[model samples]
Target: MPEGASHQSDSHTQREAEEEILAGLAASLGVVLAKPERVALSGGVFVEVDAATSDMGVVVEAYARQGRLKGAQPKKIAQDVLKLALLKREPGWERTRTIIAFASHEARNSISGWLARAAAEFGVELFVVEVSEELRARILDAQRRQVMANADLLADDLVVQTDSGR
Candidate 1:
């Protein structure tokens, strides 16, 4: 295999690890909350959320990409917008609040400005959170075999198009 392909695979794995840790946090949050709510996965998105209700609901986007890389900023925004779009379309998800959990404030701040603006314009509430130890542990423990199942399909499309164009 080419060195480039290996690097791509490694990056993909890193993303999966980051996403797993965040998913575990989301799961544990559901368990510790005072109010009763069901934790479930979005049909099209990989991460889980408290099931949507007429009053309120929560969806999580584990933004694993590092924020410091300026080159990645645009791609990250597009990725997040796609996730938000899915939530926006869900029936009875109007009241659903998207809690975007980042590893740190810097991570959150890197994309928060854009996300914050999106929330106001889109008429939805978007929140940024720091990953606590307990949340991190829960995410670590919750790692699964195929976290990339959904994302891989989309990624494959990009790869295929690139390969064919070349």
Candidate 2:
């Protein structure tokens, strides 16, 4: 591949990985994954969310990077900022919770402090997989909740089945 093509390929691969991770995280949190999903606002207009959960009113923009934080911080911040800006312009979308999920917090540790501050100021959440303590905790909790919910559903179905059989 040419030098430019190689770079483009890498970026595309990184984005795919990031999108997958974000989708899984969103699923764990009971959110449906739909990229560029169109949602009808209070008005007759509709808006596109990068990934949104209809039930929870949450949207996420994910970023994946393989380098040290110093080289990527500004760009990542800019991307998050832009996403936030677009979401906020939609009438009711501003009320929707926004998140910027990174692939790994440690990968961005060099600018972790700055990211936290910027995310907060921008009214968007910042989370990472396999790195941030908070992200792990949230994932674990969501998993537990999902399992318990499934158990309940299964039990209820079993009871209904037995009663009908009798």
Candidate 3:
């Protein structure tokens, strides 16, 4: 398969997993949650959260990776934290419950150390929603495929260069 197609497939898998996690959370919380329309912030800026209750009382950003963070994954999670924190600063969102939901404990640990403390201090709650065994297997399988793909690229003398110059 082509490299671009492979990456797109991986991304699609991750997105589906995340959507599943959000659905599980909605069931656990007994509330219907959907992505709200872009929320207005100051200066005509707007941001969107992954899911929110109809009343906007609860907002969530979910991470569905089953393993530890890799590459820019940590930064991605931090960005979610930042989004939720900024949203909370909005006038009517001050009381909104901001949560960062995780599909696995390992993914949750990506925020360990000072970042974790900072998220808590910002009133960002961390929660883990259990995914089914089959979903868990699928996530693990995708992760393994991703790792192998990276290895294969490196072995093919592709001279992979990251933007960070790593």
Best lDDT among the predictions, by candidate number: 3
Give one digit per residue, the lDDT tens place, for model 1 in 26-94.
565652222225433357444344323234455555554333425555466556655566666667766
TM-score of each: 0.46, 0.55, 0.84
Q: Compare candidates 1 and 2 on TM-score and give the better one.
A: 2
Segments of candidate 1 deviating more than 4 angstroms: 1-9, 31-56, 67-69, 112-115, 123-166
Name the regions of candidate 2 deviating beyond 4 angstroms.
1-9, 37-49, 54-56, 108-115, 131-166
- Note each model's CA RMSD in angstroms: 9.4, 19.3, 4.1
Estimate, for each residue in 44-116, the C-alpha lDDT of model 3 and write its tens digit: 9988888899898999998888978889988888888888999898888899999999999888877788779
Task: Give the count of colliding residue pairs in each prediction.
Answer: 1, 0, 0
- All candidates in order of TM-score, best leading: 3, 2, 1
lDDT of 1 at 128: 44
Q: After superposition, how far is residue 144 of candidate 2 from its true place, in Å?
A: 37
Kindly give the stretch of ten consecutive residues in candidate 3 with the minimal lDDT sum: 156-165
lDDT of 2 at 121: 72
Task: Give me the overall lDDT of model 2.
Answer: 0.61
**Candidate achieving the largest TM-score:** 3
